[model samples]
Target chain A: MNKVLITGSEAAALGAKLAKIEVLGYYPITPAFPAMERLSKYIEDGELNCKFIRVESDHSALASVLGGSLAGARSYTVTNSQGLLLMTEVVYHAAGLRQPIVMGVANRALSAPHSRFPEHGDAVSQGATGWIQLFSENNQDVLDNTIQAFRVAEELRTPVMVNYEGYLQSHTLEEVFVPDQGKVDAFLPLKRMPALDVTNPRGVNTVAGPDVYTDYKYIQNAAMEQALELIPKVAADYNREFGANSCGLIEGYMMDDAEHAIVAMGSIVGTARLLVDELRKQGKKIGLVKVKTWRPFPAQAVNQILKNVKYVTVLDKNIVFGVGGALATDIKANLYGQGSMVINGAILGLGGGKCGVKEIKEAVDHTESSENKNRSEWIGL
Target chain B: MAVKNLPIVPSGDPGALVEAANYATWRIFRPVITESAKVNPIVTLYCPDGAITVDESGAEVNYKLCKGCGICAKESEGIQMVPEYTGPKGVF
Candidate 1:
């Protein structure tokens, strides 16, 4: 392993290279484009043995990667914002077909209002598309998660999307510890399934008429359920193999004796981590739960961590329009009927808005008070 | 009233008349060649002519009645429509 100063995109590209992916199919889209370039450079330099397929649209990028995956090649793709939305159909197709294609999404806000900033809206909108979603808190996390995503996807036979804030993580440079390719290979299993052949032919994804359509969907869901059990196991194994303690379904900071908890995902969790340190000095019993795995939901791990806390504040970077925040709804659903604990959903940092120390403190302050129990509201709007 | 006796024809003894009628039978419209079934079995259900048939071996196409409409291979995984060879002169 070597220490390198790199952006999230660079880290993501390095992760793909380390994973020994065979096909790198992508179309250029901001924040994510730099990662595409990084991977292309590695391929061009002959350092990484991979086929780089430049496609006309995000749809073709994912489609071609899925095609490559069907041939038993370990494949990957990257996109952000509109590109991710454009490839949404193929994204679902990749998951439904059980293609273990890993995608790196430089999270950005959707268009119509038209802003080029970091937002969880892009990736969060695809929350229920049957893909394993992992968010990163920094450049190192981006690299680590990207490497882990391949294993997670391969084990589950479902596509995995590693999402990080667009400009925040993708453009910002930070110190990252990149593991050796040999180590990554040992940690990740060899390519398996969807093998194409000529000597003996067999049909795959041929058809699912009414007689068996729901059964296929049920199987897909069962795979997702299986993924929940495997995620923490893989993380534990990654930690053991790499001697790094960065992998887990959720990373808790000072939650042992805390009366209140602040829950969030992605880069914002990094900010919350800092705030948790500051609040400790002020004798505030506020802790933090950084959600690393979003799909397979991580409800069991989250519920276990936050069960004893009296008040919980969920900081969501994405909103469900009229339905408050998406992560907030998930936390409420998970924490229901366990205790007399109050859950507050605080929507913050949408469309690249900054989550200041004051905003977090106020959210924490509200959590301690019984005034807005179970309320979902906006912060720093 | 005298009971009217229905004409009873033996299953296989109908011969030339049966063969003539077989030309217009539903079996004629069914697919006998199944190269497309190698890629997608759904083609068996969507074949407008209902000429598609799938077995453990794969799709079998009845080229004699298959009009080569090309719908069987539509949206298929790797199924293709190859040109049929009619052979030399008029050797049926």
Candidate 2:
């Protein structure tokens, strides 16, 4: 393992290089472009034998990647914010085709009072697209989870998007432990990618009737359901092989004796971890649950972990109108009818706003209060 | 109708035209590729849906795949776009 100080964007390229992606399809989008740029440089440098295509738009980016995957190649792409939204058209098509394409999403807020800030608005909005989503907490998480994503995506024959914050995670530099290429090879071997061949031709993605469409979705959903269990297995396997503890799914930090749980995803988990430690030092019974996988949500594990907790506060970086955030919605649904556990939703860090100690302190301030029951409101507004 | 026993992977029998949509019914003017329009690549090349294929025999239009775009007739004077005798008036 080599410890190199690099940004999350550079780490992403390193991960893709380790996976040895055959084709990279991408467009120029802020925060997300650097990763693809670095990967393209690798291809240009002849260090990696790969084909890099600079596409016109994120839609074409994903479409061309899908083409590469269809032709039996381990394909990948990356985008952020409006770019991800634009690629929305091809997202479902790739999933339906079961192409094992991995995309890196530098999560950014959607426009209309445009800001270059980070938020879950981009990745989380694509929740129902059937692409497995893994939220990277830091630079190392970006590197490791990206490698793990290829295995998960290929094993399940589904696509995965490794999401990190736009500027916060993408641009921030950290000392990342990049695993040896040979070790990564042992963990994830390039078994000739299962793709349609022209010689032994097969009609992939033929027009389907209503029932057939339903069947395709049923199978897709079944794989997603299976992913909840499969992700941990791969994650554990990767960790065992690498001797590194890259948390696969949702991880419980300081939750054993705590009555209050703060759930956070993406880069915000770093902040939440510190907050939990600080709160504990003050003799407060507080803990943190870092959600690593947003899609194929580990509801069963979450219910088990937070079952005894008195109250749960979901600090969402992305907001879902009228219903709070997507993370809050999923968590609340999982916790419903099981107990009288009060679930409070607090939205903060939209457009990449600084997640201040004061904001988080206020969010968790009412945790011990009797009046903190089910309060859903914006925090850093 | 229930679409049953389909392959889960995106694979289907090559060249197997199962329940392929027939464009003949929707065509107002069908391209009649006569023997005179022999090996006209222009007619086949201009077809947006690839309804026609050209060979030594002539340009043959696959009505099932053709959208009756009339591009073949426009591109080649030998191929005529005649109103189909089948639509609404009577069953062919």
Worst 10 residues of 2 chain A by lDDT: A366-375
What local lDDT does model 1 show for residue A335? 77
* Model 1 agreement with the true structure over A1-381: per-residue lDDT tens digits: 899999999999999989988998888899899998988999999989999999999999999999899888999999999999999998888888888999999999889799899989998889989999999999988998998899989887889999988989999999998787788888986766754555655444454446556666777888899988888888888878887677568888899998899999999888888889998999988899999989878888999999899889999888888877888899899878888888888888888887867888777777677566656777886
Clashes of each: 12, 0
Reference-based lDDT, each prediction: 0.82, 0.85
Listed models, DockQ each: 0.03, 0.50
Best by DockQ, which number? 2
- Regions of model 2 farther than 4 Å from truth: A193-195, A200-202, A370-372, B1-5, B10-23, B35-40, B86-92
What are the fnat scores of the candidates, in the order listed? 0.00, 0.56
Task: Please provide, for model 2 over A35-62, each residue's C-alpha lDDT reduced to its tens digit, 9 standing for 90 to 100.
Answer: 9889988988898888887778899999
TM-score of 2: 0.94
Q: How well is candidate 2 docked (DockQ)?
A: 0.50
Sort candidate 2 into its docking category.
medium
